[model samples]
Target: MIYKVPFVEPTKNYRMIKNEIDAAFFEVLSKGDLIMRGQLKQFEENLAKFVGTKYAVGLNSGYDALHISMLAAGVKNGDEVIVPAHTFVATASAVVNAGGTPVLVDVGKDYNIDVTKIEEAITPKTKAIIPVHLNGRVSDMGAIMTIADKYNLVVVEDACQSLGGTFNGKRGGAFGMAGCWSFYPFKILGGYGDGGAITTNDSRVAKMARLLRYNGEDRETGEYYYHGFTCLLDNLQAAFLDIKLRHLPDWIKRRRKIAALYKEGLEDIEELKLPHFDTPGFEDVYQNYVIRTSKRDELANYLKKNGVEILIHWPKPYYSYKALELKDRGFPETEAICREVLSLPMNVEINDKQVEYVIKTVRSFFK
Candidate 1:
């Protein structure tokens, strides 16, 4: 029997609860509120409770969530916001969109911001630090938070890849002033299309974020208005997300189980370096299940030829391509890792036999 492999499959909890979503949609349609309505409110409240945050503001996309957070945090033009050089461009672009200059920082071997190197980069213009939790692993928040306190710099966690992930028992989106999440169909707690939320314990910051998303309407009066962009999450998507939210904990556990199976099967192979999920007290959701290999491009081609799918999370670092000011600075770690990182087949639906087949194919390539 032949088995076809896929790179990353979004969990299918939505399929199992199709009737619930249909019923919710019918109720929404009957009420004649589709855009920003009761469904959005319910999702925000439920998501906040799940993340253990005081407030959660839903937005149009993760990019928008980051953008709005920067604005709410008082980021201004010419102000410097320190960010990792290795993440998706959206992490940095959102800073620019909110009128801040993004200063690229190098990442450590764990593929997160090198906390040790952050102090030297801080300048008089430095206003905030955006710690990106890439590939579902938590960046060293304990250290990062300490640094932020020392400098009085606001921390905005870019937790797009780490919805169910945690650090030191606290969830990913609650460590900073506000943590940004992207529901771009591929995230663990994804919706049907573009969606995002900002989770935070600070009520003032949360209030600002909510106002920014709805064209600056005062939620209390529904009367006052200010200049703000329209980027609210749709009711239909929220209805769907509410259904999937119930099973998120189970889905996250299943992802970790699959990652363990991969590690056990592939640990002996020296050619591959797998990700680290056993960070002291935190649990990684294993969003991408990336592996590092010297011959990554060649291995990817071989896998595709053998009916196994693979993908590169990022081919270039954010600072190298989008922002021109930081081009002269060299980030060898980011560049080298980008060249070698390849994502394997990962999802809850993949059975034991499929995992074995993938490991066998990978080992055969190395041999």
Candidate 2:
């Protein structure tokens, strides 16, 4: 079935910068700088500057970024890291991978970790708070930072979906001790494949992360310092990401425009709840334009039948997996959100006409 409005058009995204991407491939291929090369270093520098950090370490994936950040921050056995239950599984999995337990927290109406709930979750073992800036909206960093200071907890942001987003004039990852970003193809600053970075103002954290990503090797001195994982961001993928990063500002602008169109067309529908993109001091990039309605399944089926493709981000809670054994730890907001959230097509490539059709089709369903 052909979609009049598909969820994402990656091919079109590539086409928009095809010439530059092609050139980058040719340059990297001819030079044969396949791993830990100049291309990766340049991308890391560019990303660190963009995120307002003193240093950035490129890694293989967002999961690697988070895991290495935890390791660098001293998250160890018996440590518990606070995380919102609504984000992708990687956030918690990273904690577990770093020999820590993920203490689940619920999100507020904004679909970010509820700052009010964060303090209550802290314990003697609580080591860090991984505030995920989900759906392109920045979490309340001011409140989170205050809490972290009080408890002496490390803050490593899950800023994978909010590369260009900001709060109170400060970017997401900049506020935390360390921030983890993903370049998975669908993210705001995605690459052709998996890539990620850790940004930090702390030189210690930055240096440790850099070594941890390269399997504890001192490349210049040819020394193995400690046991570490081989998770360097490939030079080829880094080159692709660097090419795409230049266009990220415009991409973020277009996503917000699409979000505005959705809000204008659908705000009046009482049953449908839309995200607030115009909140003061917060620059939302609308990574995914998710709306909440009790009739989510019905609405999703209707949208698909009408050639408007959509997505439902994790229709179930992450703890639903029996193996994880988080079944007893129930988060009410997360459970309710899973039942109601529906993500309409949010591709930057979506045209106004396609957006209009999506709006019209959604309204028709409600009517």
Candidate 3:
């Protein structure tokens, strides 16, 4: 069932950078430094500079970044952390992993946490808010920050999908107290394997995150300070990521170009709702070019039958999962979006031919 146009193709991107990646692999192996070493340090430094942050701590995965950020932000047991119900489960699961209660809140039309709804969900137990910058779009950070200032709540941005996105000239990971990122192969700035980072201006939080990624040991002396987890990003992965990081600006530009093409080609369809691209003060990287339609199921089936592959970002809201014990609560917008949103083929390597083919196929569906 190989589709003519697949949802995402990481191999295409890999092939483009194969030579550099191979050289990076050889360099790391030749040096025999596969752990907390030079490559990882260089990657951390480059990432911090890229994100406009004072520090960035590399970890094994974005989940570890979120969990460690919560711990460092002082989200203790029984404390509540407000999170969007529309995001991936990892956003809320990270709070739970940090011994904090995840308080689910509904999202707005842009598929991000509704800042207007955040305050109502806050209680005396509220400790922080984790705003997920979904699908490369930056959330309302200015408003969210103002709310945080009023409530004295910590903000940890889940910026995994927004590596190159910006809000009012500020980068995605630089808005909150700490920002978490994922390099899970499919992301905008992906790595060869699982990798993540935490960015922050607070020296204390950055120091704690650095300690928590490893087994809480002094890097220079290798002395144990406290119990931690084995969440360090491998040096080989860091090497690959460093190479990818250099090409990120160009890649992001390509993605934006593709997104604009989609918008222009599909905007005329009365049954479809396009992603918000013209929001003032926000610059998106188009990590996933998503659209909404009432005939979502029919459209997906039609595209599959016609040799095009698509995906739903999430088929259900995060809170609907039984493990969270939140089935009773309702998120009307999140639930509605779960049934309507569809992710078309979006990647740096996606060409105009493929984009036009998808747009033609989609227009045919309505006809």
**How well is each residue in 1-367 modelled by candidate 3, as lDDT tens digits?**
9888988788888899999998998888998988888998999999999999999989999999999998888888989999998998999889888888988888998888988899999999999999999999999999999999999999999998899789999999898889999999999888878999999999998888877777897787888876888898898899899999999999988998998899999999899999865579999888888899989999999999998899898987767767777533578889899999899999977789999999999999998
lDDT of 1 by residue, 136-178 (tens): 8888999999999999999999999988888889888889999
Query: For model 1, where is the 10-residue window of minimal lDDT?
Result: 320-329
Where does candidate 3 stray beyond 4 Å?
none
- For candidate 2, the TM-score is 0.98
lDDT by residue (tens digit), candidate 2, 1-367: 8898888899998889999999999999999989989999999999999999999999999999999988887999999999998999999999898899999999988899989988878989998999999998999998999999999999999999899889998888999889999999998888888999999999989888878888898888878877998998999999999988899888888998999999999999999999974557888889989999999999999999999998898898887887875523668999999999999998788899999999999999999
lDDT order, best first, reads 2, 3, 1
**lDDT for each candidate structure:** 0.85, 0.91, 0.90
Q: List runs of model 1 lying over 4 Å from the truth.
A: 1-3, 9-14, 219-225, 322-328
Q: Local error of candidate 3 at 59, Å?
A: 0.5
Q: How well does model 2 score by local distance difference test? A: 0.91
